[model samples]
Target: MAMDSRRTHRESAVVVGGGISGLLAARELAMKGLRVTLVEKRSHLGGAVGAHEVDGHVLDSGAESFATRTSDVAELLTELGIEDKICSPYDGGSWLYLQDGAHPAPRTGILGIPGDLSDPSIREILSSAGLRRAKMDKLLPASVGANAKTLGELVRKRMGQQVVDRLVAPVTTGVQSTHPDEVEIESVIPGLQAALAQRGSLAAASASLRAASPAGSQVAGLVGGMNQLSEALVRDVLRRRVRILTGYDAIAVDRDPDRGGWTLLQRAPQLGERVAPVHGKYLVMATDAPTTLRILGSHLDASTIPQVKAGHEIALVTLAIEQPELDSRPRGTGLLVSDQVATVRAKALTHATAKWKWIAEEMGPGKHVVRLSYGRGNDHGPLREVSLYDDQLITLAMHDAGKLLGVSITRGNLLGADVVRWKGSLPTMRPGHREKVQQFRNSLQDLEGVTAVGAWLSGNGLAAVTADTRRTMHEFIDATSAD
Candidate 1:
């Protein structure tokens, strides 16, 4: 019972926004035999993850590095044949800032969860009492079957407050730019808790989990700058026969009461002209939450716009300096700040040059590049500019971080060196986020053809979620085929 539903008429569709999501979507649609147009507000293709060369050094302005655990990203590279650009992370070691010294933080602990905390590496960082709590993992009765437990409640109950404060807090914040007490445990630490609850002891469960481990390094990166991946998407999508508009900003959408298709109105600053009206049977909104609301402002309902208003706030800045100074930041995988440590706004750090050799090569023979990220800007705003002279705030962080990384600064050159600032963009998982997104889904059903996807649908992290959206889009296209 083979079904032949391929439509001979190639319907033209437009993908709004040239970010990763939009670029990916355009590629997928064009591959399905549709004429696709990729539009971007900015002149460049890479959104958060972009790169530029200055003084013979290549600098990643937004996102600098990504972990290898993302299979979807890897697959995309393979599909684009850009796999050779990826370089493995240096096993140079990582350090953590604590009371007044730098200690090793676990990077290969299998998604921040380890099978045995009794290992010397883990023991070196935790106090005796902390170690005792970690050992107690074997004694605590695990849940047989039930809803997932929060990381705060579960880790503190099993691994003790120190481990949670010292370990999980920083790691989670770095990855999601979110604090622990607020982030959903099921969403962040998925699989660990559910499996722990089922096994009746986290230690036993971890041991069992480790047995099924894959044989390879846990964290890896591209051979060139991490931005190369984004560049490849931009490159390949164009070759797929899709028209890309970089300076065209979509300002509004209108319905032709007479025709059922959408009228996409765009403003191209570069051209200093208005975009010729594009009539399309299908429209896909892949811009971030806030931007999406503005573009769909006129066409969508008031109730519909509020859903886009709810978002996440993450303040991330990348500081590029000489190799020695860049080496001056936390080395290895970097440190994570514990929630219990007075304030909990900042999280983990990674050596950009050390992590991504390709980008590092651009730093010259002895120079280095690194990214400094801090979440919850409202809290860090007044304190982020902390000074070492008389300001206890900056002094406090400098003292803590310096000791952890084992360095003393003789000048201001090492502290901020050459910082690139990007204010926080808060990402929210409020009480009714899923519900609101569902409403957004329903609102579009009334329209003739529209598709939406990205981190807004699920959680952050690139490849996996994009894969999920592609699957859904394929299903949608199949069901709506006009054969």
Candidate 2:
């Protein structure tokens, strides 16, 4: 139970947190010929991008897909020899559930901001008045919403409040677990404002960004699941001789004055267990925003700590049911429910079997995989519905799924179900969040061998995290080489 007298003194890099970013950082450091030690608080390696089993099927408990905005994730997969495994989702396009009813979502859009207001699908979700106002974006100069901070403001100024409420709200709430109002425009969709300035319209900017994507869907997934990336990274890091410590939480960090590096005080999750300090030439705090700030707060000046907003507490309820009617894939990929739809408590639903061909083939006939997500960033009151018991949550998910899917799915048709909860896993990128992150990183310059990386620093999504972590690690490696 006592701390080990002998500390691990080595010329190494220490990565706290075993999420995708931490694993990638460790792998990069190890590949650069540096001894690395990865400490994970959880017993498992992957943090949000992890897997859970249900009815003999291994499903992604967290992120199942990665944004294709950049080739970073694909490149990493190729390095792991799984590039060929990258697969696109079904082309059936998702739907939007509004207060009125369900309608097809815009086919060519970025985060529910329709690139082409003329599209029939867009018209279906918007009223004649709403459409008229949205089309004004083309006539109104780019300067209209150019200075807008939040995505909601940008869309509202250029498009209409209808677009923000019916379209953008559903996507942002479903995808980011936060409303578009709180999401920083640039953080979620980079270069959008510049594109808006150049193209002279928000719709045109959305169209341009979509056109520039990798010639297919804006997102893609591994054939098995995104969790494979974590598995592959673990294997790669192990092969590179990286020492991995699971069930160990890095409670505090300090400068290793004698070693001229950093010292991490690690403790087992259990109350009375502690471990010897881990000393390394470099330290990467790759945990979530709160945990990272909590540990690094003591080391850094108070002014250096950014006031990061707390993330949403999300619960994903995945249901495996014997619904023969779902064979038709009625809802397309699934539906993003608008917050205005008081009938449904869920923010989104993914018809997994319909979206992924592999999942359908694996499940066979009359079987379907439906996932419903609960909780949003703006939920008020003390008792959240997602905090309910597993069985109760599953019942709610089934009822909500029935409403969203326009079908009658009951417990009689249920084969299996599981609920996965994530607290503060998805970071909320408020307006000026990027600037705050930059300032915090700038402050870290005073502390040698100390850096941070994660979704909190990088925007949400696997691509951003992968790209940002690799860049940070490379910079760290370059700095070390120079010294």
Give candidate 1's root-mean-square deviation (CA, Å): 4.8
* lDDT against the true structure, each candidate: 0.61, 0.88
TM-score versus the correct structure, for each prediction: 0.81, 0.96
lDDT of 1 by residue, 183-203 (tens): 656454447766776777766
TM-score of 2: 0.96
lDDT of 1 at 317: 37
lDDT of 2 by residue, 1-483 (tens): 111113353357899999999999988877766789999988888789999987789999999998887899899999999899999998888899999989988878788988888898887788999999999999997799888999999999999899999999999999998888888998889999999999999998999998987234788998888889989989999998999988887778888667678888988857579676888878999999999999888878898799998788899999999988989999899999998988999999999999998999989999999999998778865777777899999999999999999999998988899999998888899998888899899888788878899999998889999999999988877776676
